[model samples]
Target: MDKSSYAGSPADKRLRRILDSNVGLCREDAIWALDYIRKKVADGAPAMQGLPQPRLMKNYQSFAEAAMSLLLSQRSGPMEAERLRKMLREALHGLIPD
Candidate 1:
């Protein structure tokens, strides 16, 4: 991710600060990751245009968004954690488009 692009974005600053200051819940991480993506999704740099998934131009975006949703939904208890673990495993082994 380009630091310069997000440098001016207040949303990005808030999210980054949150990540840096504390270890919040998975939902918070998801929110942070989402803000990160929102900050960069509009960048029209040539390298980003070449990517297979432009929104995923930064691999962290895909990883974080997926992780956040899965983690948040399974926050109820151990059973949910186990279920999410399985889902996360399957996701890791799943296909990525070219």
Candidate 2:
């Protein structure tokens, strides 16, 4: 819930903006993901390696957007549900040290 911790990356700032403007389950999920990432960072999870920061953040943004869209959709079949899960996993993985 602390915005300061998320101020380091453009994608983080964008996500904070989205969280500030939205009022629903997607916002809640973002909050939870942010908290989880923060905790992971605090617990000394290794920073992401290999990928450039911008590229990693961009990927996270895309996955997050897809996941949010799926979450907001009222009608999702099993495949769509699985895709959402994958997006969320990828997004979280990318966000840990952003």
Candidate 3:
């Protein structure tokens, strides 16, 4: 996975904090960011047009998003956790263009 894109970053730290603190669900923007990356990967499009395609981009995106969702959803109880997990999975799946 592209840990480089996430590791030691303030955003990642903040995400961790949110999860550890048992905060509410993730904001829509975070979900959208993950979903957008998934779509790009599914289409085999450049993550950024001017940049070269990343090796294992799809795997990286999937892992990162799922990890983030898993952590963030921990704040909720089992029922809510399952709900959000499914939502995140569906959002990831929705990235595929019909």
Candidate 4:
């Protein structure tokens, strides 16, 4: 569906439900919540107060590259670093629309 309709659709409600859930939270959930939140705001409300601004993913590869680049720049230790990378990959690869 179109962008405008997507903002108000039942899919949006289902997304919200997923977001509201207490368990199984992940980067993908946050990404979708952020996206729909932005869309909802653009549909009427004011800009998000403290939310991270969304960057459009050019493609899956670009999204992957960006995440890897960010993680590399951060230079965390192995375990935390791996988790961060996984979260970013899932968020970008799974949630982002091509």
Candidate 5:
């Protein structure tokens, strides 16, 4: 994949950081979600509105699981992609906690 295709822009990184902090998705999943959410924003739907509301349940485990699965399902050969998959796997194994 092109670096730009998966690489987060500055804004994407910022948003990803927030997701990592609050939603607690690992970097791999969080960044993927950043890309996904950015695409959603471009398609006229922001993932999060600034409305203050009660916290709803978020499934960080599933998010990370799905993101890693998607990455692996791509059958990528790049070292970075493989490295990222390992990182996500580690995170899923509780290497990194929210």
Candidate 6:
């Protein structure tokens, strides 16, 4: 992604820090967690009052892969990391209904 976009953004920097420092779960666990979330969304679970349901529930595998790719790419630096993160989000947002 474009590192320039996030260069001076506080929110992106905070997100990068959080992504960099957070830990506990392993890859398999992360996959399981994502699967659980997908199942919940696919089952027609309501989002929080103001939030919309995720648009990519049916494409869970792709979404999960993108997430894992972002997590596993720690050495890619903040700009690339942000790109991956944005890619994951955009992949979710870009899905069209069947």
Per-prediction RMSD in angstroms? 9.5, 10.7, 10.3, 12.0, 13.2, 9.6
TM-score: the better of candidates 2 and 3: 2
Tens-digit lDDT string for candidate 3 (11-98): 4444333333243445553454465555666786542343433534544665575657656654646556445544444433323221
Candidate ordering by lDDT (highest first): 2, 3, 6, 4, 1, 5
User: Model 1 — which ten-residue stretch has the worst lDDT?
Assistant: 89-98
In order, what lDDT does every prediction score?
Answer: 0.42, 0.54, 0.47, 0.43, 0.41, 0.44
Off by over 4 Å in 5: 1-24, 46-98
Task: Write down the TM-score for model 3.
Answer: 0.31
User: For residues 1-98, what per-residue lDDT tens digits would candidate 2 score against the true structure?
Assistant: 55564575675565544444232334355445555555654675555455578866865685667646655876545555445445555666645342
Model 5: worst 10 consecutive residues (lDDT sum): 50-59
Model 3 alpha-carbon drift over 4 Å, by segment: 1-26, 47-62, 65-72, 76-98
Among the numbered candidates, top lDDT falls to 2
List TM-score per model, in order. Answer: 0.34, 0.39, 0.31, 0.30, 0.23, 0.33
- Winner on TM-score between 3 and 5 is 3
- Error of model 1, residue 39, in angstroms: 6.2
Output the better candidate (1/6) by lDDT. 6
Q: Count the backbone clashes (under 3 Å) in each candidate.
A: 0, 0, 0, 0, 0, 0
Which 10 consecutive residues of model 3 have the lowest summed lDDT?
Answer: 89-98
User: What is the per-residue lDDT of model 5 for residues 1-98, given as tens digits with 9 covering 90 to 100?
Assistant: 22333335664554334333223334455465535543543574433232123311122344455466665665534544445444443333221222
Looking at candidate 2, the ten consecutive residues that score lowest on lDDT are 18-27
- Tens-digit per-residue lDDT, 1-98, candidate 4: 23333344575544533333233444455455445544554564332233344433332344355355454654444554345444443443323232
Q: In model 5, how large is the Cα lDDT of residue 35?
A: 59
